[model samples]
Target chain A: MRDLELNMVFDPSEVLRPSSFQDAVETLDSSDSKIVAGNTSLYSLARKGRLENIKKLVDISKLGISYIKEAESQTSEEKKILVGAGTTFQEITSSSLINGRPEYAGLKEALNKSPPQIRNVATIGGSICSAVSFYDLPIVLFALGTTLKFFSKKEGEHLITIDSFFQNPALYGKSLLIECQFSSSPNSASSFVKLCRRMSGYAVAMTAARIKLDRTSREIDDIRLVIGAMTKTPQRLNQVEEELRHKEPSIETITRMCEKSADLVHDIIPSVHASTAYKKRVLPILLREAITTAVERATER
Target chain B: MLNETRIKVRFILNGESRNIECMAADTLFDTLRDSLGTMSVKQGCDFGGCGVCSVLLDGRPVYSCLMPTWKVEGSKIETLEGLKGKELMNLDAIQQAFATNFAQQCGYCTPAMILNAKALLERNPNPSVDQIKDALSGVLCRCTGYMPIVEAVMQAAMMRRKKTQV
Candidate 1:
């Protein structure tokens, strides 16, 4: 209901500009306020006549959260790519730290598929918050097992896993996203694929798959499979992952796993654009293709 | 109840510092075209769909239609006006290339195409044909069938390369 109130103007008296990180967190303590990062999607939504009920847009684009680099994560000493909430898609697409790792190629692929102008302006944190199905990068972020870092002046910083964050987006929406980090697994191979009516159009359905085979060669040691656009949010297929993990990825086994995952997806997301029947029919194939690509990439490594 | 608050934001606009009172609702597209008379930044869809309002914000191509005017503080903005070369009568290299290559019809998308192309050529002097296509992928040309525009960018690259070599 909050998305439909229209024609309301964003008067300057309401917009708060916080100069410091701590100040931004403190300012965001107000439950009604929304954060603005790059303002791409929010601007688009307003142009499309959405967000009518919203009054205040706290501009966080300048709150000193802009960063993109590999750093030692707080919970673990392992090196992870810590992309600040304000880090633009342009930064992510071309970040040498992200591109340097073979596992992040999936993220690079998804971000690259976004139009050039969008890449130059839209921030990854904004994309994560938008959580719309057709936005391609969320699928990759989910597939990569990314974790988001949120800061509140009162609560300090909380690192929420992607799975948990999506399960309760509203709980974290008001909080400021400071960084999103993912374990950089050298042994893993990741792939992202999307089907759209037009070459540069928004995705109809997208999949991002990451596969890590055991050193012994045949067994899939770890895997993450996520699908997007069939629903309001990106959905990770845990059952499908469970079926494939710690086992040889045979053609028959992969096919069965994809079928079961596709079935499971029908119960999860109320399908759109591509009908439920269509998505159910095609999910397994796309998942197969993405996983197959990841598997091959893993074998090459 | 809309609160009437205006902030004086300063930015380098076309090589000169200009201060303007920007409201929260004002977009860069509105600020440039409405307030400052920068007609080069066209409002096509008033959203990101049409890249007609593209401008170089700090030398990177971004759709000005969506960029909040309040966000322009301390940033340098370049429109087609900034592409006016050395002399009063002279044209930018990309503009010249577009003209020589017959890259305009109604000319609505021309400014954005030129600016986005210019941003591309600045970072990548000698981009391949595919690279050129990849760079200009955002700026849409509905009238010219895109070949001439793509050729114009290639020619501009060549011209820039030639100028550097000489």
Candidate 2:
């Protein structure tokens, strides 16, 4: 029999319902708390005794937050897609907005690169909240310049830029996440690339790039690039984007920018993966391929 | 010090209402097989790495092995047995296709596979091979590979189309 003394499973509060986050929080407040969503990754942790620290679980399955909403941007005339924290990667990839949106190539591509089982059960909220480097969605969200709306028990509701969101994920201690919103840009093309050992596993390296090129001028109007599985968290390469903002989307300029990215990655990320040496050697190659693919996609439409 | 005790949770399982008093630590998988005697939902891997313990909660497919039974109160639960006699199964399209296509060798993985496929076809009546692969990718089948399983789904789709025409 399992030892109940060392690893105690606390009794849950019966009043909590599936439809309320507040209720879920109340349950967590009563004892040592852990939140359950999808549980694909969490269960493994529990079974392995990694979560021996946790005694109470806050179930978030019925929080009524699993949704994909397209709302008009208040400042910009563009429309933004808001994905609830409970929205699974599978739901996002298969959603009509992602598959049908010509400009959302990066989002669709990132979803494709993620593993099958993880895609099915891994939620956008849980993945982002974990802040793991290998997660596929963060790079895309950061590249799209997304915003996260966090709900904290102490501070109530607060909004943070996707870049700043990763800077510190510990802000929301007891409260939960609501959703992430990213306004769709006009005349944009996106691409996502992953260097993984197989079809379904954590990424060794990954990149999500969104590029908008002026057809008449052939100059890059706007660009965003985010890299994951390289550091403490997914990073948005703002310096590289600044370098390529007005330049023509040519081979020489692209290669230079990619090289700069490799240097930045090398300096920022320590203890890279087992494939780190090989990844550093081939960073530019993958970056160039991703950029080229994004450019091609943008030009097609 | 915090006091731990059992919590009472009630939900509908396979069209019957059940009230299960369990510890918050007890997962839906454990409650079903041990407490409720619904052994159809096997525990291939309790860690959720294997999708063998998949069940339908409120009509969506989820791995029961990881979900807490206490969290499922007031929610509707359906297992492989629920699908066995449903009108959709009686059409016997997919199950019949599986039988005809030699989709099972060991047969241990069939229930999970069927449930996964059922969930997919419900969402998308006719999914491409790529989409089918995506849908069932969470499930692991150590026997017959996936080609025969894929062919069975395709044949089932064709049969559904045939029935629609008549």
Candidate 3:
């Protein structure tokens, strides 16, 4: 049995302020470092001995990773939503474009469900790096097909898909997520649903859905569904999404697609959660809820 | 072995530049309450679960109890003390609302409540009841039942908006 040390405390010998992404990477390479942005979750984890090897702390709060950039939309050129990794949940929740945009309702819902204290300090970068099941950002970013930009010691600065980035072991000892970028589609609409014991912070199950309907007819065009806390990692239900695209937006279609989610999730991770049996029995209901919410937002006149 | 790591932390406390050499193991709350004599940021729970030690770190509310002192270098740190001498008892709008509405009961949680409300209103001038609830959700108040507290925040928001419009 591994003995847990409750007596351990956070002690950093040096602090680094890196001006650029490359500089941040260089700074991390110097010693055993823990990145501090909002330091909400990271500090909590440190106190709980979750971060067992952290010695030197890197403060990245000053980096411009907290801004949201909006660009003119184009086909070849996608409208960018560059969220500075240091951007807090508070910033995201208070963001005009994010909260106001119909397409981002699911993301906003997730933000709403996150803890208020965490919302104030939990950074997008830290949430991504923490890689916990309950954290809501990863699922939303995954459903949005967001790209995580990181600074690495060997590879320097690079971008990885949120889905693949979570599997990368290099994320732990070295690379740091600096920002997340998603192509903003005006036609896109999203919904996020989580089954928690209570609304404050604890999440036993969560689902995030992003759909883009046909501009003219409002038929479902592209669909993405990501569920978290039900498995070892958040999953993108590609099979169910493929089944729904180009289909008519109806209760029947949503129900069928949702039913397919149970099979899809089982294939991904057999042991889901406490409500594994019940989740499989009732997942269609929640998925349908997410779909209905998305459809209502997408079709709103 | 008790290891003492000394680091220089410079932050804007109540809009004043506070420079102090302290042990890295010390939390920002400890640095303020114990070292700098800013007890407005109370020490409660010694963990982030209790918001009694809440303060504004760069205009965002944070639990100073869990924050390591060295991590806040070059950031703005505002406590209840910062707000006391501004104008008219120097109470900020939220503080004034708390006072008028009797939002505080025991007052142990008032400082953190005010700071949390300050952070919320700074970013959002008019937060919805849900947002207001979420903003104060971290702050645990053993008094006032939170209904009057919420009402005071609402009143403060309305009053602040009227003032701005005028």
- List where candidate 3 sits over 4 angstroms from the true fold: A1-7, A27-31, A71-73, A94-96, A169-172, A267-275, B45-47, B85-102, B121-128, B156-166
Candidate 1 displacement at residue A241 in angstroms: 1.1
Per-residue lDDT of model 2, residues B1-166, tens digit only: 4334778888999899888687666678878887777767877866565678878787666788767777687999887777654465464677888888999898877777887787778777788999888767767889789999999998888887788899
Q: Which candidate achieves the best DockQ against the true structure?
A: 1
Ranking by DockQ: 1, 2, 3
TM per candidate: 0.92, 0.85, 0.85
Q: Model 2, range A1-301, lDDT digits (tens) per residue? A: 1224323423333323446655665665644567777666665666666666566566677778899978753555367788999898889987888886657877887777654545666788887887777877788888888898877655666788878878876655566777888876666778888887655557777788888877578788999888877777887778888998989888888998898777766544534454566667666777887888888778777
Q: Each candidate's fnat, in order?
A: 0.60, 0.28, 0.34
Q: Write the per-residue lDDT of candidate 1 for residues B1-166, one digit (tens) a residue.
A: 6545677899999999999886666788878987889998887876687789999999898888788888889999999988768474588788889999999998999999999899899999999888878777777778887899989999999999999999
Residue B106 of model 3, lDDT score: 88
Model 2's alpha-carbon lDDT is 0.75
Residue A62, model 2: Cα distance from true site in angstroms: 5.8
Model 1 C-alpha lDDT per residue in residues A1-301, reported as the tens digit of each score: 1111223633334677788768776766665566788787776676555655456678876677788876754344245778888888888777778775668888888888766788887888888888777788888999989998888665788888999888878776557788888876556789998988754568778899998888777589999999888766788888889889998878788877887776686554434466777777788888998998888888787
- Candidate 3 lDDT over A65-182, as tens digits, reads 8877674554752467788888878788778868777787888888777656668777777777877667777888788888888777777778888888766635555777877888
Computed on C-alpha atoms, the DockQ of candidate 1 is: 0.49
